[model samples]
Target: MTTDRVNGIARAWWKEAVAYQIYPRSFMDGNGDGIGDLAGITARLDHLSDLGVDVIWLSPHYDSPDRDNGYDIRDYRAVSEKFGSMEEFDALLAGLHARGMKLLVDLVVNHTSDQHAWFAESRASRDAQKRDWYIWADPAPGGGPPNDWPSFFSTPAWSWDEATGQYYLHLFAPEQPDLNWENPAVRGAVWDLMRFWLDKGVDGFRMDVIPFISKTPGFPPIPEGGTPQKHYAEGPHLHDYLREMRTEVLSQYDVMTVGEGNGLDQAQMRRMVDARRGELDMIFQFDVVEFDRGEGGWPRDWTLPEFKAIFARQAASMDAHGWTTVYLANHDTTRPVSRYGDDAPGWRVPSAKALMTLLLTQVGTPFLYQGDEIGMTNFPFTAIAQFDDIAVRNAWARAQKAGTADEAQFLARLNRTSRDHTRTPMQWDGGPGAGFTSGQPWLVINPNAEAVNVAADRADPKGIYDWTRAMIALRHAEPALVYGGYRDLAPNHPALFAYAREIGEGGLCVVLNMAREPQRFALPRAAEPVMASGADLEGREIRLDGWGACICRWS
Candidate 1:
């Protein structure tokens, strides 16, 4: 029943499936070593199965220096000792498959840890065999970095190598040296490593910062007052390289491939997911998430019309054959309830349920981050030392050095928008360390865990967990919800977000109150209620409480 084709779209399992991401270091602690491991994940398989998600996009667990929370890869094939051994990883993979769930391993080939053997050899000598494996350039005229390019971490992208007499480009932290995708050997290495995982039976790959793989020739300088990321994103050889990957690796397996598209536009993103182009299955564009983000990573207020326009524009970009992804939170983004829905004391539960309704009913492959089902809110971070994300730490250091660091102001922004909020331990029960670890957790657990743990949520009949589970069930059963044509029913409504999804003759209508005030929305026609968070119907108008969401069928 879950495999039926709808709206004449291609019958791809990935299209119909729902994916959940697991950030390993915070998911669960198996060895009681204060960190999450594969064994703990295997033990928690039943929790995911019960949630009705079809795919699991596991975050990076490969061996690393923990510089960027496993994004810096030391070894592509070896599972990190902190996470577990190779045997435990295999067991965890088996556990997911045994429960009818697929695995999407994080592929962070945009860069590798400086400790990686290839980088070591590359940095050894100018004439080394692997010297070209990474992007390296001579120093500028005055003997500084090759160019003025800035990293995503807010540092210089070029790091000087004293011993090698040159600079290597790192679009991220210096520890993560960018791989030269232009080099055939590097591309071959990536393909081989992918095959290594595929041969192990992993279902797919969630490519990390994949669009940054190609860089413009000549190492051009970024324009002053211009976006730094724009200079390197969607380079000349991006599609050509993706085509090569499709032919060399992805074509051989029945696996899903989604790239992290950080700096791409709508047209560029559309090209990546177009099946006929044979580049990738889909790419994650950040328009919806970044829409509310202001300059320098600050939080900003956004209007409902603007938000609707973003989704409508994104949905319109995909044709009947093309597909996109729907997600509000991931390892890099803030919590959905905190960002999109109200997370206040009294409104948290209803708002979380409403956001889940929006996520699951959307026309794309939906991905839920860890703790999203239980309505986990952001951590009340008071100091910079509590942050585990390198980006935050780097930004804070830069602020302090520039004499612009205001303690209260920075904390406010950090509490509102830091990625560390999503990296906290998954709350299993109302116990110490949120029952995620018997010993001390690597990061402090959120204090609200006692009230927001999975055990507590699942125990309540009207909790967020049940609402999310029911929504997932409905999406899995209804073909229209999976591949339906989307229409913004109230495009100009200030506070009411109403849209209809149609597939052939049958479809569903979704109405959401995005503000704190109650909203009365008029339906285009009469409808039968399917499910709702907190909504009431009076005659031709549906009244929704603050952050209320409802789904219905055409009468």
Candidate 2:
């Protein structure tokens, strides 16, 4: 009975699947070397399987200098020694497959670590055959970077290469040199690397900042004060390159591909993932989650009405058969409980469950970030010295240099909103180092691990971890939740975000209170309760506690 309905959307295995994002360095340290590794992950596959996620979206574990915590890739085909060796990676993959889970490796082709062989050869000499593999240009007049365009750190996006007497482009950190996609050599190299992984029996690829691969030819400069992203994000050859990729590599395998697209709107999303476009399977856009960012991308006011609008537009985009990757947190974002849900002493677990309910029941692939199931909260960072993320440090320094933000206030915000909030070592138990490791951790564990952890939560039959398992079970059983038409049931409600999902004769209504105060919401009709986050309703007139959410079906 379950397979019959699920098979409707299960035409593509990924469509009916739920993915969990794992940041290896923080998940578990198998060797007790103070960092999570492939061996560690292989040892912990039971935790993921027990939680009931279908796919594991493992972040980059490739060889690197850890400049951006694996985002800067030094070798595409080799697994980082910090994580484990090739044999250990294969063992981890085998473990996942044996447990009925798929693996989606991170694809960081936008740039390569400066130490990568390709970048090293390219930077060697202007006459070298590999010199054109990267974007290089002569220094601008007055001896400065090629453009005034900003890096993620707000500095120029180019770095000078004294050896070559030119400046090379690095849209991100200087250590991550952008690959010249226009160079067929570079494109061929990417395809070879992708095939190397695919031939190894891995399931899919999560392309990192993939949209940034193409840039305006000739590397034109942006206006002194204008937004540079618009000029560099989309290029004339992006779709063509994606089509080439499909024809060259991805088409030969039964695998999924999700690109981390930046500055993409509805049309661009459709162009990239529409089946006929022959580009990608789906994309993870930032519009919904980024609506609450304040200055310098800190957390800000997320009004209910605005959030509803953002969600409505996002859902509307999917009406065209274009798929999306639904998630509230990942390696780069803050934890959902700390970002959107109330994390007050007694409310954190319930609030996280509510968020899981909302995310899992949506009509798309769901990505569960590590530790989110047990309601992980932010770290207690009170100073800049506590941060290890390059993005946070850059932002803090920029703010400090500008004299616009107070040190204490910025530190307070970092504690609440930085990516390090989610990067803290996973709390497997209440033991030392949160049971992630007996050795020192790469990053400090969240001090609340004793109270909010998987071991403790698993012991409590009704805990959030159990609730998440039930949610995944329900989603897997219902076709309506997987491929249904979404209708906003209470669009204008200030505090209640209500919606209905329907497919054929089956349907479910989901209602969530987006505030700290309890809310009373009226049902459209008499309905049978399916599941809830905080509290159950007494009748058709349902009352929801703070940060509560529920799903129901019409009788």
Candidate 3:
């Protein structure tokens, strides 16, 4: 394909697009029910479109029991009554499509709620037709779980079911039973579900925890105190499963399909997304996002080099391959400004914009979490009782049990890094409920709503929101940015981070100052300033003030 044709195909209107992620229950509520609904999302489609988002990736709002915050899906074909009805969902889709925007719904097929019909039927009797739909095995001779695999949420991966007299496999919470992807019938059923949604006009799917779908057979136990994930995660047949999914469902449509490949490395990722691979359109790699959790997981201390190294490696790996999806904040993470940038007074906006510069200039499709453009910071919760996220609550309890720290201190850390940070109500304005809803919000709105909101920032010419819009526009206007290869420019510069994206004679250099003091750097003679996060640059040497970023055209 020619470059133009490839751009046309890969861009998919949705590819050149910016996608905003909405955590439904916390986005906005139209009915004063303390829960955000499809109607609320429909009502705000205009706001998203106005913000230049070409697609909206709503986190799961399917019929779920909320065990893992809607990730434990009970019905793939139906909308959760708590979120709204199918009719409401249809309206939301219609609204988005009408506004020339696409919608990427969450596809959580790796697991299902324990109450799902298939699971219920499968657990009812060994002779049930769907008995093989979910992974189930007899307990050990001593009557315990079949394996020593630990759940992602810190419990046994296998849960005993008294009614079934067998232990069901759950990679996450006990309430979420993993589907048996090894069974052709199960894969067929899930593919059917995918087609059903595609038929309904969903632009694409953000396949959830897709890497965990296929597990090693035989239900072998992990060696004591070992990471069983190495054995069970991204198992032998994961690529087979994805390829089958592509052949059966994804290939049939001209839509985007990004897999949430939690543990995939560069080689596996290339196989999963390369055009010849026929597996997925793209994959969301966590090498960059996982830095916040640090070495020991979740609460380990981190620094600038640690964060930069991960992102740099991830970016290089993606460029080495065909494509990758990039993101700073998502429903699973805290806001980037709070976690990565200096969120104090005057520093927050520039720091947020610098992060944006870093991501948008990299080689990948950039995903912007809702409210991230406005520099939304993390919310503070004094007590565990205030947190609505199941993962945070579970981690807090685990930390306390491990005697990691006192309740107050642990809860503070939870508040800082919890997924709840992204789940908080969107800050639209300083008005009622941060202009998100007319009534009470499902979760606490960030207290800095007045300082960080769409309305206030949109009015400020130099605000982070406008800077984000400019950054996106720059990417759209420059093919070198969207399609070119990436190279880190000043890899070891103490306070300066720089990279170049080049395509033939077209290319651009992106320079960002990570420090808060003014610094000057020598640039190539061909470099000419095209845009800057703040201030202006000239000649071979340019000075950047505190968290500043500049994009220069190289001809």
Candidate 4:
């Protein structure tokens, strides 16, 4: 019933592969510089190899002004001078491939930094050669934005440029203007940029904000206070653009393509990832990641059932569609340990491992963010000025300007929940600079770095790192954990989360206690525990301790 025991099954490398996502700026700095670089990543390739990951998904390290933390790419064809030189990047790619590992570079083509050469030239004059390379429009006769679209980061989505006497669209931040995908020349340029990286031996691309590429033509205005995203998020021409990209660039190589479909529902997601659809190989859904965000009219109350329902829906959809991608934490979300589990009482390790157990057991490729294996928690930011994320600052300013009764409280929550919390430096060790840098870090390392770090966890056999390794190994060793069919188990178990994955002649069951209190449940008579978050299972009935999880194989 193990993977080795199965017969006549076709295995894809990525299907069985585990991936580690590295936020380059915070991963590790080798030159005593405050920021991490390509050389720093090269130096840590050994660590990634030891962790048994098959691919390293490096977030945007392209040339940028650090606006939106490199999501605002200025130069797609070259590495940022701040990070390192082209030679360093080439060496890093070569090193990864030499070790039999693959690399996935971030593709931020949905938008570009205003400082990009293309944007600069496009904005120089009304009739510039590249004028239509970016979305620009004349202001309404009333001397205001052409539409009533609100930005994702809390401002008017259109920014008026006095020099050009026109308005440009920016979905996220003013510094990142939306690219005009409607222009064939612009699309061809993006394709050329992609080809540039592909020629450099990059195995694949993790397309950022891919759903926003195609907007509704005519710049229709949403009603005031309405969700502008409904009209623009997954616009009409999205499939056309994606299909074109597939034919021109993606299909040219045997590379994996995962699109970040931010606001897609189940039906829409199916159309995006279905093999017959010809859009993308997979998509990163935000439903599960957005669980902690409060619902309308009741923003602060945390609802466990709502979270569970969202997870169930997503898992069911993936199972129905035959493929998907799973992730608990990423560079743009708060650490799973602090957000989903009990970050108090130092129970981070068990909780982190438990969440991983729950996620990886699902029917999808699992993405492990850097430092998650060692139980990294969110970094605390005391002041708004210290926050580097535009979204956080904008939200804080909006709350303050509204003169809300709990303005300070709102800011505090934003600080704790913001993506900036996860962008802090990795906790490598208790040594100076937490072993992430020889100099000051780009952002402060978590205060708990002394207790929870790679070095200490690597030394502890029963640590979170070891637990994650075991879980990953299980995924590789068991057929049910890899190519199996998923079915939710004990849906009404309340404190216990469980699911079953069945592969041809074998099956495996995963169980997790999402709460801090111990829970007892009767396991299927044919099941036997193969791995667990803690050393003891407590009883034959499968009693899970606080924040504990286990995997069982059934014959």
Candidate 5:
């Protein structure tokens, strides 16, 4: 592995590499089980390797109940039988490594499934040996939850245990009980499980809700109208826990670590990922991805300047130190084309390419969700019954129980912001099941799979997938795109987003037309066009034809 030292800071492969996330359950299915498995992933490794993503972030496939689509892990060291066996998982890992790609398994240490051995023993009785492994508290004076904390699934964060006669804290679904990080034994167990994978030669981790592992000292009650996340996010001992994790497990290997920094501001983000801090290599900040999120799972409108400013601020935050992820969508988000790009008939291809161009040209490491490269759009969910995401189901149930649910309006929200939009099966071909499976898919395939499958996309040289492949190649070929300073040329432009990435005397200028109307941008300096999609240039003046993008090289 080659390491670049710029400004006395070490930049490793992850800094310059593009990462692709594989939501295993929805990616591909082998053995015709209607569920994707390790074997499925191994069989499809070529798709990712050909796409040129150096890292593959595989979501949880551990022994899980599938309650939260595999986020509720039942065992730390075992693969879910539904997904595959341990041997099959080993094959998948070897496949990734063999393809010159590293695997970052989802590290969901903040909580474990209620069925996990530790949680089972913890909930068996108050005097169980593992009783302290999870957060357990007696009912409050009012006979309710221990505190006013709320679950991420839109319910109280506590669930009463009949056998133990106590309420256990669960930041997500009740099936997922948050572990007690204050306990030394729990920390030791976590470190051991991490090493279990490291010893097996897996790359690193995409830590899920890592900051939420630590809690406020006293578990204070929230003030009126205050959000629950504000009280529990980035708790007092977060850095201590992270540093201990680094010392005990992470620093031993040359692996990458990216934490989900959901509620963290830019400064807090820097504090978590700054190399000097030794906490993490990078963190995913939601400032860019959550712009469309609104109250009660509804979608909100956002302006281009607002969107551009959020990204610029994120880039600025990492300018001096630390690293951040550049992504438009993930398993937890709506499809990027539907959310950020023009996914309509003629504009879909260009807009998808343009968005990817923006991602690859950014200074931070870029991450691509499974089907985003093919310009996948949101699914038209007509009924709530079709939704499989726990977050969406819980939110809808809560609204219905409160008698405030408008079926039509809520369905619209589900269509716009629900995670199911991105959880659909990958479109490998236009055939039955989109070539994902011979049997029925676990989830509904997008209706436009026939028109947007990879088979069709790869056939067209200018299609989104090929454009993404070429962009990844460009990013790898140009060191400036990864290590350069970012400067926005049209920060206030309504339809144009132009930025220059400069390092030393060589640099690349990226121009993106973010609208359907054609736009013209004046380059800050003379440069020759290197790549373009739906764009043309004449004498340092670029004319972007409706959702077009262009990359210019300068030396």
Candidate 6:
């Protein structure tokens, strides 16, 4: 650990890094197999280097049944055959290290595919040697599922196994069975998997659904108004297991670990990622992300106050005790331009640029998802059948059965809420298949790619790519953006969002007009214009253009 201690706590490399998230299957396809492989990823090192990212956080590419993409891991130590061999992954790692960037592989220890050897042997019989490797329970009083707990799928969390006369717990799809982390043997096996990857020169891990690793004793039923996710999130032994992991495997490496902390609150987040806890370096919280999730987890409109409130809570991480991750989009989220910004033809460029300005200037490691640099929008999926995400499919089916909404309403909602929105092929150019694959892509390419693609904006000075590059460079040069004090300038202005970051003698003030009409924000003092998304600035007040954002420096 090259950490500098101050009263014992120290600064870590991850706090100063920007992670570029890549969904392996949709990044690039080098083998012409139509699915993206390690070779394809290796060939794109130049792109990442040009973007000036500090780390490449790749989603899971482990062997699986494709039920939950690669999240349902069949083998933690081995890369999927579809992605390529271990040799290709090694080459990819070397390529990343060669460019002065770290590689963080997905650590999906929370669960494994039902076809995994451990689960197969455990389900064979009640007295099997590995019978406790997964959570299994007998039927409830009515000879049905063990409890009223719901799966991410519409069915019960427990799937009955006739061979064993018991039901196994699957928090997600039936193919993904939750691992019994209470077992010391299971914890040891997980450490082995972590060691396997770490020994191969991989830098770190992005723990998938990490909080779900532990569970409450006695498979409990969901209360009348309670959600099933709470039943497993932040379970009793979660911290104990994480600390064990830290001591056994993580402490041995000079690597960073960030947990996918969905459904976790501010206090829970602090507990999970506290530097002194020996658990994780940081975590990804879903506070602001959930603002748009309405009833039944569908998309809904959000007011500016709600957005500000979420950030205020998230910015609480900037305190001496914690740190947070700032991002607008990822593989599971809709594109920033389409989801958060105005992606209409005329306002697309500035709106995307403005969002980039907001995210990068915040007090956290900026997470840039693939295609975010060039301002990619969501794929306009026409029908539900074209969608392949199991979660989305299950939700739509459940909604249909409950008559919550009709077919048309559900499809419209699915178009906005589906994970498939972000899984489309990358638009390299305005060509067939967006130059993503020579053959057919596993998913549909966004129809708007011809107009909004990397090749189009790579050289344009006013393009989203150039804007992001310039801003990232500014962040590298400015200490205020890295470890500075945060304070909001405009707390309640509906259309205007403004904040300030104070360093020793200088401060960075960011102002934005979220509405379409022009707006003006009164600055605290006269400052020099550092950067602006929608131009037009003068003295103590700057008139922002529609969806415009400006950054100013004062000393």
Which candidate number has the best lDDT?
1
lDDT of 4 by residue, 76-192 (tens): 877888789999999999999999899999989888999999999999999999999999998898899997788888888999999989999999899999999999999999899
- lDDT at 137, model 1: 95
RMSD of each: 1.5, 2.3, 2.3, 2.8, 1.3, 1.8
Please report, in order, the local distance difference test score of every candidate based on alpha carbons: 0.90, 0.85, 0.81, 0.81, 0.88, 0.84
Query: Candidate 1: lDDT of 364?
Result: 82
**Candidate 5 RMSD to the correct structure:** 1.3
Query: How well is each residue in 155-185 modelled by candidate 2, as lDDT tens digits?
Result: 5789989898999888899999899999998
lDDT of 3 by residue, 1-555 (tens): 123434223444544666778889887787877788889888878777766677789899899889888999888888999888999999999999999888899988888999899998998898999999999899887878886788888778888888779889998999999999889999899889989999999989998988888887786777665565455667889889988988898888878778876766777777788776788877788866665564446466655666666667766665333567789889888888887787998999999999988877776778988888889999977777778877666776786788884777666567667888888888878987888878777788888897789889999998887888888878888877777766777776777887788876568988888879887878765678888875457777777899988888885
Clashing residue pairs, backbone N/CA/C < 3 A, model 1 = none
Clashes of each: 0, 0, 0, 0, 0, 0
Model 2, TM vs. native: 0.96
Worst 10 residues of 1 by lDDT: 1-10
Local error of candidate 2 at residue 164 (angstroms): 1.0
**lDDT digits (tens) for residues 371-396 of candidate 6:** 98998887777777788888777777
Q: For every model shown, what is its TM-score relative to the native structure?
A: 0.98, 0.96, 0.94, 0.94, 0.98, 0.97
Candidate 2: Cα lDDT at 467: 92
Local accuracy of candidate 1 as per-residue lDDT tens digits, 164-216: 89999999999999999999999999999999999999999999988889999
lDDT of model number 6: 0.84
**1 or 4, greater by TM-score:** 1
Candidate 1 wrong stretches, greater than 4 Å: 1-5
Q: Clashing pairs in model 4?
A: none
Weakest ten-residue segment in model 5 by summed lDDT = 1-10
